[model samples]
Target: MSAAHVISILSSKKARTMTESSQAMEQWADKLEAVARRQDTQAFEALFNHFAPLIKAFALSSGLQRQGDHLPDELVQDVMLAIWRKAASYDRRKAAASTWIFTIARNQRIDTLRRLSKYQNDISADEIWDLEGDTELFGEIRQSRVQTQVRDQLKELPVDQRQVMAKVFLEDKSHQEVASEMGLPLGTVKSRVRLAMKKLKLSLEALDL
Candidate 1:
């Protein structure tokens, strides 16, 4: 075929893919609406079948798999239960069903992490800092002073970087969790956290001088 014909064929394929994706989303929305309106078990079952595996994978990718084999399964169950309970609140005009479901999964994952972290009694000042390197300067100061200095430096960071840093260090979210929540790539989230840490280190060192 001619080059123009190949380009035309590719464009048609792309259009078909977009159309198929939209149709799938619409079907999911319809199922969710059915559950909301009637408490339809079959509709909910369909949604569960479709989204459960996806939720499990999302939890695993966020490092929950390493936490325990059962945690990912528990997270998936929690997300699906939230969907069933909150189905009445779903607004298709505001978000697609998949978006709403995955958002619940992300939030559920964060909450799970927080609950797990609470059991750890050994978290030190350095662990709270969460920075990659050991800055001797931070070790010399009281944790309270370090916290104040870090908070001040955090304010000076660019908003994008600062938000990622807050999620990772303050909220105790994994980088993958932040990436999923913020709809950014994993590498992008990690880079933002690294950049934020470097800035924090320099600012704190200057304050110590």
Candidate 2:
């Protein structure tokens, strides 16, 4: 076969493959829109059947699965549930259906892992502190140590961030309450809190050393 003829054939095949992928993606987006607009059960089932294996493979490959673990069924369910809840928020103009759905899955997985880590941290803290110890003394010592660390870290933060952390944590105010009181955007308040949490986690970890 001539090299030119082979090159043309390969180009045609590549174009056909791209067109097929595009069509499949459009169908998926159409089904997602149907679910959003009409609560179409069939459309959802179609999505579930098509994407379940793909999501499971992604979870396994991404380290969400462990030794002897076949698939992250719970993670997949959580992602699907999130998709159902947030379907109305999907924008085709912004991203394709596969990208949108998988982004939801990725976010859901991250949130799940964070919650699990927090739960494990809580358990570890409980195990370390004698629950049976003098409850009052334990509380007092724990509160004192935490307050000292927080105060030290607060000094390290930027002035604006420090203020937000103080109002939210030290004052026992909700993020929304602090935002309203400070006249800052709620997002700014939340961002400061998240930054504070990261720094506090690091400082607290160092204290353990």
Maximum-TM-score candidate: 1
Give the TM-scores of the predictions, in the order they appear: 0.56, 0.51
Clashes of 1: 0
How does each model score on lDDT? Answer: 0.74, 0.68
Reference-based TM-score, model 1: 0.56
Ten-residue region with minimum lDDT total, candidate 1: 126-135
> Model 1, 87-177: lDDT tens per residue?
8977665565665676676667766777777564444432343222233443423433443456457678999998788678544478998
Task: Itemize residue pairs with steric clashes in candidate 1.
Answer: none
Model 1: residues with Cα > 4 Å off, grouped in runs:
119-209
Off by over 4 Å in 2: 1-3, 62-71, 119-209
Candidate 2: tens digits of C-alpha lDDT, residues 125-155: 2244332234342343344344445545656
